[model samples]
Target chain A: MHIATRMKTRTQGGITEVLVLVNHPMDTGLVKSPITHKIIPAHFIKTLTIAINHKPAVITDMGIAVSKDPLIAVKLKGAKSGDLVSVDWIDNEGMTGHAETHVS
Target chain B: MNLPRRTFLKQAFSGTALAVAAGAGLLRPTQALARTWPTWPAQSFHIKHWRDLEHSLFGSKPVVSGGVHLHAPLEAENGAVVPMVISTKLAAPKRLALAVDHNPYALATLVNLTPHALGFFNVRIKMGKTSRVRAYVETADRVHTVDRLVKVTIGGCGG
Candidate 1:
């Protein structure tokens, strides 16, 4: 599966707002396929990492309850223009995706 | 010359072995020590009720307070995509977590933030039905909680 990630950052008054959207199915394994009537194996992002200027800022450990195509936002203090904000996530199936953007 | 080449090969092999070990979940020194990633609470998330989730995560009942703000719609048109935002003016919160009272799994997401980061976050969650969603903000001394009741028009969990 080709997982896609997009990140956006905006800095104002020393606080940078970071928004990230990751493309993932986030199946809970409890749901069954409509046509096949088979249980869909659980596939979701277990861990998500956010970094500012290559330094770890926030680490989110998620469960199956999180929505599909997860959209996460966090605010960073003391961030400035041109600071790099990056996001990475690993799913239950060992798949990973990464995206980075600079604060504007 | 031969001795130096052999030493270089040995060092390179050991480095590769270390990388493999880390990938296999054997050694995670940096992650454990530097807070690069917090361990997922699989057992806590498996709890199905509000009390059980609270006991597992906080070791006691957290105090319900207005210090934490939970922003969510009174009625979610789609249970599959319920937007939730949590923010607090509390100082240097160590952790933030969410739980859905009526879902099969109570615990939704837990975030570990560094001291420098703000105590605010926004995310989307799924609701099996109309349920109460709770957010917990843990500081050094206390665990503050806030909950909101949301009516879901359609169930999110498909069978």
Candidate 2:
């Protein structure tokens, strides 16, 4: 459940968009080892939540079927030019990753 | 006396004509039928993870959103790493996720944003085969999702 993330922002039509990419294997346990012929145990991000300036914004419940290195995009409320946004997530196995970006 | 011979000959000719027509129709439409729309499985799904979202066990749910857009190649040369992008058009967005059908694990990625997030993301993923990629966006009060199909040339995950 090791996680890594990157964030970016852009302005369009007076609104700001935030994009993020996360890295993880997200193994679904259904996959078998190519050589050993054994099924890999299911492991993926289970719960994810987002906050803006310490306010809860979004939360998600996930399972093992999610793809590896999932990417996410979200829009923030009241985000204007020149603001700093913070992003973070935790996986079912308790691994966490965080990133930040400045709005332009 | 001669009536029977003439009648038999007429019937045989008509029957042969019908068979030829049927064979021509099959050849003309076979390729079109091959590209028919995808169908959901018939049985019920007992999905324990995101990867099983397309099976009969996992029911279909409507996803709503106005800001999230998902972009990926319509056809991928490799199943091991297909490039994709998800972008939000909202002024400020709070959450984003990627869901896929026909993959062992369907939920591919999730991201939480702080106040400064502008709502855009990109990455590459291993696809089991051909699949529809779905992007879920969570804003202040609602969740929205958009989907696109990506055909994988090679099976990812050693499928």
In every candidate, how many clashes are there? 0, 33
Question: For candidate 1, lDDT tens digit of each residue in B11-81?
Answer: 99999998898786534332332345556667987888888777777775456677899999999989999
Deviation (Å) of A47 in candidate 2: 3.1
lDDT score at residue B69, model 2, on the 0-100 scale? 83
DockQ each: 0.55, 0.12
lDDT digits (tens) for residues B27-144 of candidate 2: 6422222233122121212342443542222234434645678889999887867877887776556666676777655666555555544566655677878988888766675666
Chain B: TM-scores of all predictions = 0.75, 0.60
lDDT score for residue B88 of model 1: 95
When summed lDDT is taken over every stretch of 10 residues in candidate 2 chain A, the lowest stretch is A51-60
lDDT of residue A90 for candidate 1: 78
Error of 2 at A16 (Å): 2.8
Q: Which candidate is the best by lDDT?
A: 1
Candidate 1: where is the Cα deviation over 4 Å?
A: B1-36, B60-62
Judging by TM-score against the true structure, name the best candidate: 1
**Model 2's TM-score against the true structure:** 0.53
